[model samples]
Target: MLIREATEADWPVIWPFFHDITAAGETFTYPFDLGRDEARGWWLLPPPDRTVVAVDEAGTVLGTAKMNANHHGNGAHVASASYMVDPAHRHRGVGRALCEHTLQWAREQGYRAMQFNAVVETNLPAVALYRSLGFEVLGTLPEGFRHPRHGYVGLHIMHRAL
Candidate 1:
């Protein structure tokens, strides 16, 4: 597999899984009925911010990630990132590769640390992956996320120094 910068053309392929994942209401906070244009605007960030895709040898996109400042001005030194892997591609290291790529990008860009503002506590795979990558749960906001099937669950604030 190869990791490379994402392009506008990749949105069409990404939308299917992106929509499926968000609509599941299991992890991401995006509205279940989020539209394509709105999602495109949110995922395809502009310069200074970065978006990338993990593709197979045949060039099939397996996953994607977007990284940027967690906050502006005085808070810009800290970075944040989001990842989405094709459900069909889970457990194949797609998510991990995207995360590793994002971390490298953040470090190269001079970020002092990386923080995830709203990680659903129930997303065990993600929580484990982040932990394995050296991120720690700083705290959890109790009943912060209203999971579709699990009712209210905590949202973990995870962080790690670069």
Candidate 2:
């Protein structure tokens, strides 16, 4: 798969699954009621930040990831990111590829570290993936998220040095 910068044209392709994933209220911190315009504004970040799409040989967008500084001003040395894999394309290593791409990008950009501020604790596959990629859970905020079915659950703050 080829991972490349996303364009506005890609938003139509991304929004369906994006809606499903966000509306599911299982992983992301985005509000469940996030609408198209607002979601687009949130996901398609501007310069100095990067948003990429992982596409198959046919150019089908399999997943997307957004990478940026974890904080502004004095704390900008650290990077942070978010990912979303098309539901139909899950389990095919798309997420891993997106993640690895982001790591490389962060390292190349001279980030001191990469942190994921709010990984849902019950998202086991993602937590395991992050662990395998060398991210450590710095801490968990007790009852940080209200999972649709699981009630309140912790949100893991995971990190890894570049």
Candidate 3:
């Protein structure tokens, strides 16, 4: 799949999976009821940060990622990123490709480290993927998320040096 900078036009195609993923209320911390316009703003980040989509040869956007500084000023050296893969495309390496791309981008941007602030502990596939990519869990907030099916679950703070 080809990973490239996302364009405004991609929003329409992206919104469907994005909405489904968020509405699932099983992984992301975003409000399940978050509106489309607000989600567009949140996912399609501004300059200095980046938003990208991974597409197949047919140009089907299979996944997306948004990356930026974890914090401003003193914390600017650290980076952060979030990913969303079309559910139909899971187990096909779309998420892994997006993650590897983010790591490369972070390194190229001179970020000292990258952090994922809210990885749901019950999302075992993601947890394992992050681990395979060298991200370590710094800590977990007990009962941090109210998963739709699992009740309360821990939220992990995962990190790795670039």
Query: With candidate 1 superimposed using the best TM-score fit, by how many Å does residue 120's alpha carbon deviate from the native?
Result: 0.3
Model 1, range 119-155, lDDT digits (tens) per residue? 9999999999999999999999999999999999999
Residue-by-residue lDDT tens digits, candidate 2, 1-162: 999999999999999999999999999989999999999999999989999999999999999999999999998999999999999999999999999999999999999999999999999999999999999999999999999999999999999998
| Model 3 alpha-carbon miss at residue 132, Å | 0.2
lDDT of 1: 0.97
The lDDT for every candidate, in the order shown, is 0.97, 0.97, 0.96
- 2 versus 3: better lDDT goes to: 2
Model 2 residue 25 CA deviation in Å: 0.3
Model 3 misplacement above 4 A: none
Per-model TM-score, in order, reads 0.99, 0.99, 0.99
How many collisions between residues are there in candidate 2? 0
For residue 66, model 3's alpha carbon misses the true position, in angstroms, by 0.5
- Backbone clashes for every candidate come to 0, 0, 0
lDDT per residue (tens digit) for residues 70-140 in model 3:
99999999999999999888889999999999999999999999999999999999999999999999999
